[model samples]
Target: MQGILVSILVGLCTGVGALPFLFIKKVPQALKDGLLGFASGIMVFASSFNLIQPALKDGNLLSVIGGIIIGTMILTFIEHLIPHTHTKNYDENDDSSVLKKNILLAIAVAIHNVPEGFAIGVGYGTGNVSTGLSLALAIGVQNIPEGLVVAAPLIEGGYPRGKALLFSFLTGIGEPIAAAIGFFAARLTDKLLPFILSIAAGAMFYVVSHELIPESHCNNNEMLATYGFIIGLILMIIFRTVIGE
Candidate 1:
């Protein structure tokens, strides 16, 4: 129950992040790329330090490796199966293009949130309050940028602010659902915890490499994206240090 509540709060951070879009009518391309980059960096750190490292410590190498492979495959399969728009030529004037891109972004973000929710669930299910809280905190913070990533393009593409924000918030709804599943699964089998953790990490890695990084660097905002990534990384490091202390 507590875990689910925490997961809900973490998931809602996506909506919270989108709150800024209410007042701002247009989002700059550079800012959008930077937000995406920031999200990528946060996910990378969470995947490494929060998920995979801990899994390695708690479970065997084989399980961890297998989980990672399975996780990556799952995401790959979803990407291939889903019919969403993907293109480098994003013309804000083209309503069709904008709609397709927004759909794609929403799908990607929703998919990414599942593993994050699972991580949170696994942490709490393992009876580690600190672990659960840390995962929630990291994911929650990262979700802000993710929300912006979802809402910005829609707004730029001429979608109403209310609709953009709704879409962004809706994409995060998957997290709580996945969190419930993870919590139950973790409670059922302690032996699978590490593998599950690794799976979540792998999924996040896929999102960063396949979705976030590419999107961030696509529009000649590579420098801003890179800096955003660096800032996110540093922020995570600081968070970890403070938490450790």
Candidate 2:
């Protein structure tokens, strides 16, 4: 119960992060690319350290590998089923293009939040309130930057500030939902947690490679993107160090 409530608060941090955009009118293109790159870097770090590494420790290599493959395949299938355009030739004025882009971004963010919620749920499931709260705090802190990542693109794509913030918050709502699932199903899913985590990592890897990174580089802001990526990784490192794993 406590975990579920904390998960909701963690999810709201995404909206809190986007609050700045409400006052600021415009975001530079280079900055947008950098933000996207930052998002990619954070996702990559989370996938590798927070998900895959822990999975590897908890399960066999073969099973973990299999889970990753399955995860990638699942995301690939979803991508095909969804009708969305890449950022290469984005047209902000084109209503169809804007809608498609926002949809894809929202979906990617929601999927990314699932594993994070699971971690929170499992932490609480261990009967350690401190551990659960710690995980919640770390994730919540990280979520602030992610809010910017989501809102920036939407605003750039011509979404109203209120709509962009709403969308960003909506994407994060998945975390609490997944946390609820994880909390209730923890005992039943214990043996499968490693595979589940690996699957999430794979899904995130696909999102970074196929979605965020490409979009970040689309504007020829590769240098800014690269710098943003480094800073993002560093931020994650600092958070992990300060938060204690």
Candidate 3:
């Protein structure tokens, strides 16, 4: 129960990080896309290098592949069903429906948050507070841009200050929900944890390579995108090292 509360606090705190965007002016398209790519890279590295590789050491390759396929398919279908709201940095100018884009992005973040929170819960369940906190902090740190990703476009779309923040905050709720589910269900078992990590890795990798990188490059800002990716990677490395995970 204590662990669950901690997980919830961690998840909620992540959402709160979005509050800063409301006060800032709209970010440039190139910068936004670039940062999105950077966030994508961070997620990719964390999920792949940290989560999936470790999982693969203990889990079956076939199961890991299956999990990735299923996770990818699941995200694909959801994205298809939901309307996509491109970021402010879709190009020099973006004219897509902001509401639709925000909703889709929110759904994606929400869905992604679930597994992340779950990973934290599972860590605690295994009696590893440091591991759980590390995971939560990593995800939380990763989510700051995710919050920006949700709000920046909405601000472009003409959403009011409070509403944009509110929506961004709402999208972030998936983290704790994931934690609760993971803690209660005990899904992150020794046998199953690796597969679950792989699923998240595949889903995140697809998002970064397919969605974020492509979008960032659409603005022809390769340098900016690369910088963001490198920065994100470095930050993750530092966090991993400090956390000892």
lDDT of 2 by residue, 1-245 (tens): 98899999988888887898978866677877887788677767767876677778878898789988987897788777764556676687788877777677667667767766766776566465655665676567657766777787778666899988998898789888878876665546667777766776677678778777887788889999999888878887787777675
Candidate of highest TM-score:
1
Per lDDT, the best of the predicted structures is: 1
Per-candidate local distance difference test? 0.83, 0.75, 0.68
Tell me the number of clashing residue pairs for each predicted model: 0, 0, 3
Candidate 1 structure, TM-score to reference: 0.93
Prediction 2 TM-score vs. true: 0.81
Q: Candidates 2 and 3: which is better by lDDT? A: 2
Kindly give the stretch of ten consecutive residues in candidate 3 with the minimal lDDT sum.
Answer: 85-94
> What is the TM-score of each predicted model, taking all chains together?
0.93, 0.81, 0.81
lDDT of 3 by residue, 45-110 (tens): 667755567667778889789878876886787677864534543343435544555677777777
